[model samples]
Target: MSSVVVVVVGGGASGLTAALELKKSASAYYTSPITVLVMEASSRLGGRILPCDVPVEYESIGGGVLYERVQLGAEYVHGGEHLLDVFLSQKNIKRIPACVAAQGDGGPSGFQESQATVAYYCGKRKTFIRFQPDNTSSTEPWLANLNAHLRSLADDSNATSSAATTGKSVADGLPRDSFSREMADAGYGNTLAAGSCTLLDEGETRIMEVAWDKQASGDATPEGGMSRVIEELAADVCDAIRLNHYVHTIARDAETNRIRVGYVASYAHPDDANSAVPEEHANEILVDAVIYTGSLPSLAHVDVSPPLPKVVIEAARGSSHSPVAFASEAIKAAVIVRGCPYGEDSDTDLHAVICSNSLWPEISFRRAKVGDNLWVCGGFVSGTCAEDLKSACISRAGAARWRNETCVVLLEQLDSMFGDGGKGWRASAGQLIGDHDAEVVPPSNRVVGAAAYAWGSDPHARGGYTFPRLPGASHVRASLNAALWPDVRAPPFFLAGEACGDDDGAPMTVHAAMESGRRAARRAIASIAGRGTLQSRM
Candidate 1:
């Protein structure tokens, strides 16, 4: 068989970007055109770009993924500037700043929400320090910043539990008497667990072990929603795209090192009725290279020949596959009969109200552009976002929400926050470019404990981006980026994904994923094109 240059598996941003780059760059190296195949478990191409189909008036009522004024997922992006520049530049899209300092009461929002915390060894009950701020003119709206400072301090392995121990550290700056006293009482130690942070023991708690340190300086992102980020990338090869194609597995022959891939045909059994061969089975493809870009839950379905390496199987199984969630027991619609509240002047900082349980959402300005003119403008809500925001993002606050409109209610999980203190906020549908506005009403249901955004629950991305609990990180990049001489003989199976690399120990973000894809493509070119790891480029 004449080898295939690359087989890209994922259909997400990274996979698509890699395939696009490989298709364009690989031609220069190979005598024969390098063929690239993108295998996705789902039928559609936008892996996590599912947008809300709600109403523009919901902005006044509170519902949206990324308001035209604030960026959500990719909102607070930092390190991947170069990466951002390339994609945005290629797509002719412009990026805007979305970060600002504490805009509320100067005293720490002075409020905090307490979360369920379990002491690892002691098994003692201490709360994870969370905030339940009064988004009104109570205190320093810098609640997010203050908490961040505390987190940075908490992340410091050497950060003395007591200022006396480390002699004037971040702990010293904390207003022990002001508000975080509650957290201080709960105590701080390496033998602790917070959120999704899983440590391999105290040794892993070392300062450098886990740093929120992004590659480059991170800044507030698009107020225009990050969904547009993935959209623009797709525009490049949208023509070469296929939707609703579910891949069942990959078949391989160990003896000859030959491989065949399969997919679930849309219309099958009927055509092969009463026949030994059903055309509806997996659609197989034989090529020089293969790449899988689906999520972990999706990976469970791929059929690799002779079985995947034991190590690979074990690691994949062990890795945590969860989604970015937003839960609310009651979906409240706060419509001010008088004025719209948003931007600089308002107390909520104009961002969505994502409560501790995903209330009072503080998304970036960059995401706002994506909004279809649904942001609540002017004035402010007097009371805390409690009535409408609630303790969580689980259900609609009223019967009207569920009965009057459409919504998928998720409950019993932690709200996942990205770079900042936002409770994992998702999308809410709105009006189009020029559409009629609708009345706003809050949901009748209210969440008690947790309103999680479980991406694992989402059919699209088996789970959210990769986390670090699973093993094989160091070996991740190598396997995905490896290439062999097919003419020389051997079963070639290379892998690349944020799940596959170290990325200097950061969790799976868009940055790490894209980098892994490039590494894989470059490796294919060098070995097959007969070039070694060339300087810088590779």
Candidate 2:
């Protein structure tokens, strides 16, 4: 008989959800009793999706804005409606009414453009790695399966229509599919293509259910911030969490076949990023297992006994270490020197100012409540790789910017050159994007974060949640997911998180990650008991 039960690591959205689902389903589906241990790395619970209060005076500054410019963080929620539905069923979250500007709303709440594709720098790759998925496992102890799946994707050249109608890669959307087309076109492509590239193989997983429409609508927030949702999820799994515990190492016991987790709980405190620390531990934590939800850089810095495999390490790097920076200078707010002449809507909440890149239009009075004594706080998303998008936004810009005519020109060209799967290739990307972000919310901070949450760069994700970048990205996520399979004899080891998915193509969204956690718990419960007890009697 095995000692103890299943062990879950990380307490972020994925970890917490996985633990709860397993515990819940064991009683319902498996008819078995199960206990799960969650191991989180940070002193705080919510990972990057933090939703704190920003004074109205401080609106138009940092990652927070009043009329809600949702600077560069998990502010707007793109295609997470399904997840929102799930949250509404499970928590106290409520959606607010949003008004994305149409051309002639008597309200004057008109938008210039919108998009569904995410734009980020691929570093100097000159060729930014276009992430995509292969819909296969990386661990069957063979490379043939990988090769086969990739070939199928590459051969999807029948000019067929895919489930996604968004735009395509800039390279795939050129005038003659020419080099200049790739150059003249902006660095970013359609939202679906970006998801395909970001999630790589993981996108192949059910997470692909996400919709990516720039001109579309329906993105939202927790009426507050994304953290409220995280807090709600945490409430369910609070019994298993231990805060301020900094994990140090993980080990495996050859004799007992059990995993050992180690960490220094309370060590010297660092006052700042460059603060020095003492060696003594004020507190400590050790476990039989560990779930590492930290970033790739954080993972690389930690120590592990018996160590992980080369493939896992390689995948971690490929999936997380994209040299892309998050610049959002375009969506910046300006000091209200002189307010707009036609901007006198008492009930109006959010508004946009369109301008040429070279002219570099300046905006003022980006506060929640418009007033004469307005002072706007602002910052630039400097050093980021996607400089083009950063230069074109005001407050909340991005794929959702497709509502603008100026943005339509860019999207239309992209679609004409690379229609859904490059079929008709004569329409506009903006039109396709129109169908993705289909909900109705003013293109505020909530909308932008909703749009960016799926990608990794939204500060909350630190870089579009996890996806296969190099060849190994899929393997890491897949391997981790499989480790908890029912066929295995040892106690199941479940993994979830944008970073903890299969190399076989998975999209990183709270919804996808949540479903993954549920599947993991289900698989673990099935594996622990005999297969006879897997399916319910009913």
Candidate 3:
């Protein structure tokens, strides 16, 4: 039996999962010896699962410093009984609830009582609306009505049809109030203008597939962070991964029927003086099969010898198609404070603060403790807000400037929401110690460390994740699931990523990525074995 060489184009969760699964499948089912290689464009193994260390110094308390690893990407484990949860359990990684109510009696269902405390601040009214888990019925009738309306859109057939025909976006079907619009922005990670009604309808279908089993299990995070999952997934396959190998082209040899992969050995930093000069020398490798797990937007840049099917290309470019795919921009920023910034009256177990009708209409702050006294307040910006931030940051130069600007905005927003006449945060304004890389001095003395990541600015990942932009665009996901060479008896090219997930699988989740990888791996193995098809098996 001849040895089979399989090359995985990206080293993200999907790619790593594919490489590991391929090796395992080959041993279990095929006679040919399989060699799996993962090519990661960046210098690290994890693609978007970046865990960054922020060094914090307690200058007010005699200057004691410590470095804490904070999740810069893909922090939460969405549901349970998925591959990610299984992997984490096997690794003995503890799972903690992402949200918990600070003070609430158990609800009729028992689940609502444990729900996180979400404080809604209305900037226009200069008032705060607290959504207490136990008091949803009596205190906030509007919130309950909103929830019922959303559920009807998903559960009632007539409501779905009405939404599909009359509205361009999910928000269009909702009440035109500022509160409703703000809630939509926060939930969809995009402004109401960008939310597609088709996407919402399709998403509801996908949710139904797993909602029964997963409804009881809420969102969770590992004891430390998502980095633990990456570490465990890459443990056995680390040596097979090639870091700093940027794949440029993928071509198929008509005569030999083998796939040729071309890549550059090193990636030049965008800020480097010589970044403008293209690498004169390129490296190439021949493999029996190829699995691409990179972002859909990134596929447009890779030169395919025989162009991908027109629909795939259209999906990649977000151009003319029944349904177009758009890579949405998102930014995550976090700052470490010496003490709880919510003040003394605030609950210690407070989970998140959601602000509406403000400068950043849907900006929300999530709280987590990294140390005994140090707490992390993180905010995420997406959709049009993210695009605006990207444009503003570009005018200021590069990532360093962007990080500083983001931190400043975070502190300002926090102060505006929680500060007393904005004096609380302003009084704490001292020289922002630690993180010498940050050029801008923060305006708060409580801020000990700061960090931010703009996914739109990342060269490898042009945006955070992908979403259907147009009315019929949700169908593109099904098209993406098919292999590039589906007609071929033994297809050599397969696509695996969160973007490639089908209706049965939820897109844009870690478990979905892993499931796609597993499916692609099984198909690749069957193809190599001359089995021709694995659709039924998968």
Each prediction's whole-model lDDT (CA)? 0.38, 0.38, 0.63
Backbone clash count, each prediction separately: 108, 73, 2
- Per-model root-mean-square deviation over C-alphas: 11.4, 14.8, 5.1
Across 67-164, the per-residue lDDT of candidate 2 in tens digits comes to: 43233234334333454447755575775433321110011111222221111111122221111123113322122232233234333443121223
> Against the true structure, whose lDDT is highest?
3
- Give the worst 10-residue stretch by lDDT in candidate 3: 101-110
Against the hidden reference, what TM-scores do the models get?
0.58, 0.54, 0.84
lDDT of 3 by residue, 1-538 (tens): 4567899988888899999999788777655577899998878866778888887764554666667777778776665677877888888998866552111101111234334455666665566666665665677665565455455544554432113443244455556764544454344433322432234443433233233223334566688788888888889688789887888888998777888888887764463311333443468888888999988777877888788988778767757452545645777777776566665444443444544544343333434454455667776656565776666655654655555666666666767776744344423434453223344434334666778887776777767676544233346666676777666778789888867754433346677788878889888887776753222222
Q: lDDT tens string, model 1, 96-201?
A: 4322212211122112211111110111221222234443223433344445555454466552212123223333455654333222211221112122112222
Off by over 4 Å in 3: 59-62, 100-115, 157-163, 168-178, 189-216, 269-281, 320-322, 345-352, 359-370, 391-400, 420-423, 426-444, 469-474, 531-538
What global local distance difference test value does model 3 have? 0.63
> Considering every candidate listed, which one attains the maximal TM-score?
3
Which residue pairs in candidate 3 have backbone atoms (N, alpha carbon, C) closer than 3 angstroms, thus clashing? 323-473, 428-445
